[model samples]
Target: MLGEPSYTMNDLFAQLGLDSSDEAIDAFIEENKLSKDEKLVEADVWSEKQCMFLQEEWKKDAAWAIVIDELNVRMHPTA
Candidate 1:
């Protein structure tokens, strides 16, 4: 039988650019009060929220960039 994928604190810390020390990771986990069994559930929800926020922000920024580029091109047509 195959086992489930597992990640260490170091792997997560490196991915998040956080301190790799046990104390730092432990404090983060405790502050969030994440139980071992519920960790995946909480992380999934958090990931979804972050993805939504980024999508909205990216849409806004892209719209602004397009508008700015159009205005610049109109102001300097031969550039």
Candidate 2:
């Protein structure tokens, strides 16, 4: 159902132009994290495709919603 993750965490990271490897993903998250006070749409690190993917998935808000939300929460705010 809705609780199941649609995209693998790796794939999701790749779509954002981040390394898809687990360790790299972790490091990327660490390096690009929001201040626990920002949203993904506000982040500037995403490539145009990455940004579009995130934005569209956010709009879909279905199976992809969970991972999109996670990405949104972790992305740093645009400088």
Best by TM-score: 2
RMSD of each: 21.2, 4.0
User: What would the per-residue lDDT of candidate 1 be over residues 1-79, giving only the tens digit for each residue?
Assistant: 1463444545545544567687876565455443334423234424665435434534565433343233223333244
In model 2, which range of ten residues has the least summed lDDT?
70-79
lDDT of 2 by residue, 1-79 (tens): 7576678778787767777998997787778777655567666677788778878888988677787766655555443
Off by over 4 Å in 1: 1-7, 35-79
In candidate 2, stretches whose alpha carbon ends up further than 4 angstroms from where it belongs are: 2-5, 74-79
Return the lDDT, model 1, position 49.
55
Name the best candidate (by lDDT): 2
Each candidate: what lDDT?
A: 0.44, 0.72
**What lDDT is reached at residue 79 by model 1?**
42
